[model samples]
Target: MRLIATTWQPVWHETPLGWLDRYRAALAEVAADRDTLVVFPEYAALEAAFYGTVTLDARGWMQRGANHFDAYCDGIRALSKDTGATILGGSGFARKGDQIVNRALFCAPEGEAWLEKQMPTPYERALDMAPGEAMPILATRFGKIAAVICYDSEFPPIARRFAEAGAELLLVPSCTDTEQGASRVEIGCRARALEGQMIVAMAPLVGEVPGCEVIDVNLGQARIFCPPDGTSPEDGTLAQGPRNAPGFAILNTLSESLAQARKGTDVSVFAHWPESETPQNPPETRNFR
Candidate 1:
């Protein structure tokens, strides 16, 4: 299946309407090819907050009360219907009654959505966004897919659970602040793909937002990960924005080459290393070998 990963370079301080216009144009440009599945990065929807006084410790700033968050979801629904494309709508503050959750919306061409991202990172905890309880693996014509936002991918258990639940493709929507941040995220993407024996696609926000550290500098990087046998295709990368410019990185085909690599031989080099001969209950060293 063809997957188009859109790494947005949103100006952090723009109004919702302004952002909508820019995003709509970007989406139109990226979706020029009708049959593509597009994925946006985290926080691309709330660029305004980045330039504001919203700190990780300030819960009030991150609140997305029912009416507002619902509107966002409604907009996403419309986007999916209009584009006739499947979208992993990145991460956002979703309200459920008086509580909020760090959530991702996966909308199919039929205008139906499946929400995921059960766990929020420590940074998100400041906003009092509740962690999700269920990790859903979606079934699509392309493959069995699952999505996790930013920090969730840092944890091995979460990726493992998705793999166990039969997800063949993992999508990650991230918002990171530094080039190092991008590197770290990309490393995790690779690790997840290798360990799960699946394809991993990561889209990160690539522009500056005045107040937020990540958005204020040149810190955006996006990449796709596959198995190492040169069979899964190259890792797709998107621009860092401003100087580099914003655009989409298209994965023309979601190859199952990684799975093929693991069929007869261990494709994970780290897992295949010779085991150490140390005893299970070796005596404690006391200045002697």
Candidate 2:
């Protein structure tokens, strides 16, 4: 399977049509082949509001995104169908009854599946966003795929659950505002790959768009990683884009890649995880000082 991820940049669309065209072009660039999966960054939907139909204030982005969410999402579904590739179309704020939640839109050629974010960042919570129940694992023609949105990637159990469920590719769609935030997310993605022994792909939103306080001053890049065991790349990185640059980080994964990770010559993080979960005696504490 070929994986492509976008280091997307935030920009103002003069209209909703412009937003759809941008996504269409982005997906079109890499959808020429079969068995390809592409991902965009979290809150990519927020960019559509810059056209002036809604207020650009951070306080109002959630509502604006909710109002215009489904229509833009339909456009993404059509792109997936037209390209014949599965797409994780980033995330957006969608109204789920009285509460508003951020959702990851995963679309295949057949249809669309929405995954609610299990964790919300401080920034998102401050903006009055509610989190979902848990991360989701979606089965695909190639293999089982899963997603851990942005801050959710920081949690080991979240990624571990997907691995336990027989997932192979883990999608991480993130949007960050600072160097620390970006590095933390990068570290989380790498750690999850090592622990799960599954390919972890991250696509982030970059650049600053004036008048859009929600996703302005974004950070991070598109990167793909796997376990550093003998069977995979020693550095654990399969592909990555230039820092904060807008482009796609593309790579191919063998169907046997996950199989190799567990049986490879190494510390066996994935295999040893279950043993670590077993009940063990507490570490002996001593007063050395």
Candidate 3:
């Protein structure tokens, strides 16, 4: 399977159609291959309100997002069908009844599913976005896949659960304003790939769109990683895009890549992972006195 990790830049427009066209263009570029999977970063949907239909401030964006959430999802569904490619359409605020939740929409040729962000950042919490339930291992034709949205990728157990559940690919969609923030996400992606022995791909929101308070300043490169073990690239990075650039980092993976790696490698991290989870005996009770 070929995957495209997009480094996207948000821009304010006078009309939603104009901004939506840019998104369509990006999807079209990836869909040209048909079988390729594309991943967009967290908060990519918030860019729609950047057209100024809603206030450019954080509060305004969230409110408008709630109001227009359906249209946002419908558009992605249409794109998925039209392009004939699977897409992880990035995270956004979606209303789940009375409360708004931070959710990422995954659209495949077969169907669509929502992967809620299990963890919320301070910025998101301030916006009253609710945390999601535990992640699920998603089944797909290419292979089983899982999602670790933004900050959630930093937590090892989230990816570990998915891996144990038979996920071969991990998708991480993120947004960060500073290089330091981006690095933390990048490190998390690398770490997950190393320990899980699966393909980890991250697409980050990049560049600045003035007036969009929530994502006004963005920084990060889109990249794909695999285990550093001998079965895959020694460095673990399969592809990386230029920093703060708007483009896609594309790479191909075989159906048996992860399976073969787990079975053939000198060090079987995936197999050994279960041992780490073995219940430990109660700690010994001893007093220095």
Candidate 4:
């Protein structure tokens, strides 16, 4: 399957329609093929509010009004139908009764959608976002795919669990500011791919949000990770954004190329670790000398 990952600079705290126009235009440029999977950066839908916050508290920043949030979901549904593309709809503050959750939605062309991301980060906890209960791996025509949002990538066990559950591809959508944040996420993606013998794709928000101090410098780097054997040309990178602006990256073929790498016996690094029989003791005679 072809894949497109986007690094978008969202207008802080704007309406969903405003975000759609910008995102749709970017999508139009990258969505040349219908059989493409697109991943948008987390919180790009609420760029305005994210940037508008003088103090960054997760739950406190999101507007509780139902109309605004519902409109955002409505826009995602429309985009999936209109683009004929599968989307890893970036993270959003989803209201589920008395509390809100930091949720990511995965929407396919058939109008089927699944929600994931069971835990939130420390910052997210400050916002009082509720944690989810289950980790689901969706089986698609392309392959067995899993979804993870920002911060979730930091935990190796989370990625491992997905791989163990038969996920061959992992999709991550993130909203982060510092170079360290970007680098850490990138490293994790590569590590996960190497260990699981799977493909890992990350889409991060590029540029700054107005009010948030955490995003003083825009980090717009996004990438695709593949196995070390270099089985897929699409493995390296489909597209990349500018260091300081919004852009989209497209990989024309991902699934088939990844499968080719998985066919080899020596492809996985985790299989090659040296076994330890016992701890070696220091030589007493040598110490006396």
Candidate 5:
């Protein structure tokens, strides 16, 4: 399967229709000749809050995003139908009862699902955004997949469940306003790929939203990583895009290759993880101390 990830440069729009058109144009860039899945960055739907000339702070824009979330996703679902390719529509804030949650929407001609971030950053928590209690697995023609939203990618257990569920890839959609933040998420993505022995792709929101405090200055790149084994890239980087650029980083992989990787050229970290968890007495180390 051909996997495409983007470092999407956010643009301000005077109208929601203009934003939808912009999205369509972005998808047009792929020119896919075979089965493909395109991933956008986290908070990709936050641009929907830019539907007007007025500026809003993190809280205000998030609330606005919550309001327009469903409608904005409907627009993306239309694009999926039009293009016939599965898309991970980054993420957006949505009001679920009294709490607001950050969620990534996965849609294709066949089906659609919403995956939530089980971990919300401190900045997000300060704005009253709630952490999701569950992480749902997404299924597509490609295979079972997990969309690990932004900071949630930093956690091990979250990605492991998907890997255990037979997920071939973990799609990370992120947004970071600083170099430090960007590096952290990128490192997390690589670590997840190595530990899971599965392909992991990351796409982040780039560019600036001049008046929007939440996304004023963005930094990120599109990267695809795999286990550093003989079956895959030895250094774990399969593909990487120009930093903070508006473009796609593409990688192609087959199920057989992934199966072989898990079976082992040097080692099978994916299969051997269970042995690490078996209960045993702690090794004596008092003499070293």
Candidate 6:
């Protein structure tokens, strides 16, 4: 399967129609050859708040995003239908009652589904955003997939459940203010791919949006990771893009070498995963003499 991770920057002045055009152009860039899977960065929907006249704080921005939720999703749906590409439309704020929740929408030609971030950053919590309750593995024609929104990618349990559910691909959409923050998420992506023995791709929000306080001075890099064993890249990095650049990291995930590495490799981490759970011998405590 071909995968493309799109590093994006939110435009503070774009209207709903402008957003539609931007998404259409981005998806078209990757889907030129065939039906490709594209992942966008988190909080791309925050740009919707820019339509308002007032300067919004974090919570106010999230509320504005909630107001335009449907239009945000509809743009992705139309793009998916038009380009015949499967897209993870980054994470957005959705109002589920009086509380706001951060959610990621996955759109395909057949239909659309969504996943929420179980864990939110301190900044998000301060904005009154609620964490999600469910972790679902999305099923698609190419492969079973899952998404971990920004900070959630740092938790192994979240990614493990999806890996256990037979998901072959994990998409991570992140938005960080500093390069250090982006590096933390990058480490999480690589760690999860190594442990799960699956493909892990990340798309992060890059560049700054003038007058947008929440997204000002954004920093991130697009990257794809595979197992570091003999089956894939020794360093586990399949592709990486220049930091804070708005572009795509396009690569082929389905390789004969990777398939062979999974089945028979120098060391099969996927095959030996159960060993970590079941110990050969139980620990015995010895009293000090």
Say which candidate scores most in TM-score: 2
RMSD of each: 4.7, 1.8, 2.5, 4.6, 2.0, 2.6
TM-score of predicted structure 2: 0.94
lDDT of 3 by residue, 123-197 (tens): 889888888875567788767889878899999988888888888889999999999999999999999988888
lDDT of each: 0.64, 0.81, 0.81, 0.67, 0.82, 0.79
The candidate with the higher lDDT, 3 or 6, is: 3
**How do the predictions measure up, each by TM-score?**
0.78, 0.94, 0.91, 0.81, 0.93, 0.90
Off by over 4 Å in 3: 31-33, 53-56, 254-256, 259-261, 279-289
Query: Positional deviation of 247 in candidate 3, in angstroms?
Result: 1.0
Candidate 1: the clashing residue pairs are: 118-132, 177-214, 208-215, 209-215
- Cα lDDT tens digits, model 5, 1-289, are 7888998977877777787888888778776533878988988887766766776777888888888888889888888888887888868889888999998788878777787888999999898898875546666667667778889888888888888888877889999999999999999998898888887889998997787788788999999888888756668888888898788888776454456446655877888899888858766667765
CA displacement after TM-score superposition, residue 232 of candidate 1 (Å): 3.9
Please report the TM-score between candidate 1 and the true structure.
0.78
Which is the winner by TM-score between candidate 3 and candidate 5? 5
Local accuracy of candidate 1 as per-residue lDDT tens digits, 1-289: 5776667776744355555556567778765334667788876655534443455424444552223455565666677777777777756666666777766678887535555456676666755678765447777776778888877788877887788677888888887776777777788888887777677888887765555442355355556666665443344222122322476767665544324534533355324422323456776767765
- Summarize candidate 6's per-residue lDDT along 1-289 as a digit string, tens digits: 6788878988855455777777777766665433578888888877655654567766666777788876788877877777788888877889887888888788888777887888989988888789985546777765777888889999988888888788778899999999899999999999898888878899999998876677878899899888887746778788877779898887775444236435545676766787898998998999998
Better of 4 and 6 by TM-score: 6
Candidate 1 vs 6: which has more TM-score: 6
